[model samples]
Target chain A: MDKFLCGIDLGGTKINTVIITNKGEMVSSYTLPTLAHEGPEKVIQRMKETVYKVLEDAKLDVSDLEGIGVASPGPLDAKKGIVLNPPNLPGWIDITLAKILEDEFKIPVKLQNDANCAALAEYYFGAGNRTKNFVYITISTGIGGGAIIDGKLYDGANSNAAEFGHASINFDGEKCQCGSYGCFEMYASGTALANFAAKEIEKGRESVIKDIAKDGKITAKDVFEAYKMGDNLAKELIEREAFYLGVGIANIIMNYNPEVIALGGGVANGFDILYPIMIKTVEERCYKASFEGCKIVKAKLGQNSGAIGAAVLNIVFSKN
Target chain B: MDKFLCGIDLGGTKINTVIITNKGEMVSSYTLPTLAHEGPEKVIQRMKETVYKVLEDAKLDVSDLEGIGVASPGPLDAKKGIVLNPPNLPGWIDITLAKILEDEFKIPVKLQNDANCAALAEYYFGAGNRTKNFVYITISTGIGGGAIIDGKLYDGANSNAAEFGHASINFDGEKCQCGSYGCFEMYASGTALANFAAKEIEKGRESVIKDIAKDGKITAKDVFEAYKMGDNLAKELIEREAFYLGVGIANIIMNYNPEVIALGGGVANGFDILYPIMIKTVEERCYKASFEGCKIVKAKLGQNSGAIGAAVLNIVFSKN
Candidate 1:
């Protein structure tokens, strides 16, 4: 009987479930809206249904499954497999997701932060493959990151390491939601770009974003679209955002000196505009010797990175 | 026969040598002026002499010695054991210190950056003992740092990881010597304090620093002394410096989430004045859960940390 595994990538708005063979070949996968307003129990019930659905579609019995993994937004305890008050997920206090799933499926279950899962996915199958040490950063609605050191996830003293987005790049720049000032996410994340465009438009700055927004509420996509059309304000805002992103990357280089830095997420994927300037700034700012020959590249895995990484967690730990 | 080890801490102004038993008992130690103006060849010769002297004083011979370790200021390659243009060691470029010493003594040699040595020493014998992960920061003329992850030193791809002082906290604040803007060292280091005071005096501001500095050039020590006497300007300056220090510490917590953060060096030792304010700022900025139970304490080992750590390098690697 060939063994199979399951992975769940859980977020506030959605849940992704995947079933794969032990060798990492995907058998089946599915996505579902979380309906978080219905509370943790309901969401968890939906997750169980998704897992069963994936297993059934792959024509695999529950007995063929070896383990399960979950990638969750966290400030949670990975060891205890508990979800504790992540900012993205509301009404989830101390839910022990791992134990619940383990009991439900009668198999081992592992829990890791979403950023860490993304990093692990990159390390094994994406841009950071074969690198002993690397930093994986995701620049979506908010910035999230993880570090792989010596080929293993670095779960800091309290299992809350690699909070890269919260590392303040400007101590006096602006108040952040995380209680810090000028966090990289506040200046360079997709939400940050949208927020900046909205604020500027509210202040009566002339720009095409007003037309793109339709209802006068700008989005990061609108800003990018405006930049593509040669809007002067959009160009300036993006330049400023790129400068801060570069600073954040430079800071990571100085602090971690990882073998590779793989950038992913929606904002980073605006490569035609952001990648060139961000790379140039990093080269100009980081130590010459350290940056020389160091690889700074786009992440290879797309939306599936989180689910695949989550699934691989059991494989990695079993090998260890 | 019992084995012995030798450690050399080489700096711009001085050289410290020590001989210890395999079990880490100090047998003999000595310090001498570096005489760096004599060039690398001469300095290497002096280092050889110092090692021999320590062995002789400890009543040991070449047959009893296991290996030697040297900790030096970096920009050097630890893997290659070469010194490559450290800022403090002017005119010394691409000096193969480890190979030369190993060839001379016919024993293995290990080379590490001074800050890393300090972190290693602290890991085994100081504040970070028994802590699986920690960050060691030195706040002297400039900031320096190293990290110990999973009970081993984390030397990134180029062996330049944990250049904490160079991590920028302000992207557009001020230009740094390393061609970056607003480095943490530029805001929180002792040199930064002295420079700030000098600039204020140059601006013709009213301050007791003018009286404290007979030569019209203020030092960090001079500012501290004036603050003790209740000078308003000194108080304001110290407050600003403490705020930046707190910001740096907060950033470290967010980025690494280490179990402990050990602070050392001249500026950090002035704890009676800086600790309260610095702690307050850090608590106000960092994620409350991550900071909980995390020890932010003074480094246990003093000036000898570098020498001791260097000697422990070979022992650590040999065991591995």
Candidate 2:
């Protein structure tokens, strides 16, 4: 059938809506702040407004579309289409997100976690390119990942599978917020890089990281900026970040043995600088077969990946 | 479809052969010493002898069987039906074990790694019992595992996907034989447990572990024997073993998110003793969503698991 698909990427800070043809061509898209501090009801209302706006911009009515897909922060049940309490979205306790949207739009709605959506998006339209076994890892404030196994996204026993960040690299190193010890995120996430720099600075190690950070706490961005200016501390921290990232990647290689590992999120901005050392480190740690079979690349889809992935959910699931 | 199945479990020390019904009832079985030092050609000859013996014992000819399955130590190509150089099997380099068997028996034959075979056996006839997503972990001298995903055995990119032993738990800890730093096997294998005990004893924390071992090297068995005698050092070493095993298991849970994790091999013989501490540590390290969903249980098939798994390979893969 010739029709459009609607998608909503419901993030902590922004609500993005898009309308795309069945083949994934963009028709209309809209974005607005989530204003999460205002709570759930208003956020839900604004999400509806964006959907209507996208439909109007595309010059089509609801009858012209198949259904809507919502990608949200998880701990949510993709099967039940309920939003459990996600730390990112306050007051979303067991909310029937898909049902609400289905009732409001009078069409079917599907929901999935944001990370899985990005993975599905990359597999279909970006770096992954339909590889039967593909993994997408995002390394921003925290690390997150999704595995597309046998050409479909794996959601695990719960909707919370592929929590790669929580997998420990140091079992006795430090306690993590998730009640685990020495999580991969604790050693390799962008937040970890920044935190390491801050602690070293607090101990009075002199570096331009402080000057770039100004009066605020040192951020990974500040460290990256310092690395551009020949700051020794920044160089050291980034090198360690690359090494740590390689360790985490090797672990993923051991587990999934995927054909491609597409990197995304903020820290991946330094992909060029990180590639050489990161590849060397992964080579040292992983087996020859899995490592040789896998390609480590940067993700192709940009900021709109979530929207594209959500839109494709109905398409992919219908095919499944 | 009603024909019997034949299985051969080829190991470092012994070769076990079995004939079973398609539904998994054992008909006849036999075991013979492998004498691996006698090299590949002789080992292959002996393996054929045992298969004939088992068939004779069951009063059935090869023509009466559906197919034969060979389970061997890996680093081999299961798809190609070739046995590569496994450290445990001397002088075996790209030997076409399956082709040889197929020619000898004039029947279809399947070859899979030992760990994967055990996982298949468990999923079909034992503890796993048709669980869609299941993992089988065997912690012996070394740790090895196999995964069953979506009700099918997951043969990853190179048939080496579930090499969990090599996934590091300590990035800066010990260098493993696989050339990776701080592998889970280095910290938690039964060999590791005994090595940890031996090191502590060498530093002179007096215990009956030394007495139990006599002139022999301190082994995981010796440690358990001393634990039975209320030896403090043995107790401490076992406690550490439980903790490290838990850490490795938590990592598996993070990656696979399977519904069941069946523990097998020598270390699992002490499952009752290790259960309390191991469960506590896993609970402490893993996320509740997965932890609550998974059951860590002892394998049901005992030593015959290998033979049973190999026997069922044709039954399972034929359906796939």
Top candidate on lDDT is 2
Give the Å error, residue A319, model 2. 3.6
Model 2 docking tier (incorrect/acceptable/medium/high): medium
- Pairs that collide in candidate 1 are none
Q: What DockQ does every candidate get?
A: 0.75, 0.78
Q: Which ten residues in a row are the worst by lDDT in model 2 chain B?
A: B153-162
* Candidate 2 C-alpha lDDT tens digits along B143-252: 88889988888867878878899999999987899989999999888999889998998898999998889686988889988988999998988888898989999999
Off by over 4 Å in 1: B204-217
Off by over 4 Å in 2: none
**Residues B29-135, model 1: lDDT tens digits:** 98888898888888888999999899889888877877888999988899899999987777799999999998999999999999999898888888997598989
| CAPRI quality band, candidate 1 | medium
Per residue, candidate 1 scores C-alpha lDDT tens digits across A173-268 of 789888888898998899999998888888999999899996777878888899999999999889887877898999889888998999888886
- The clash numbers for all candidates, in the given order, read 0, 0
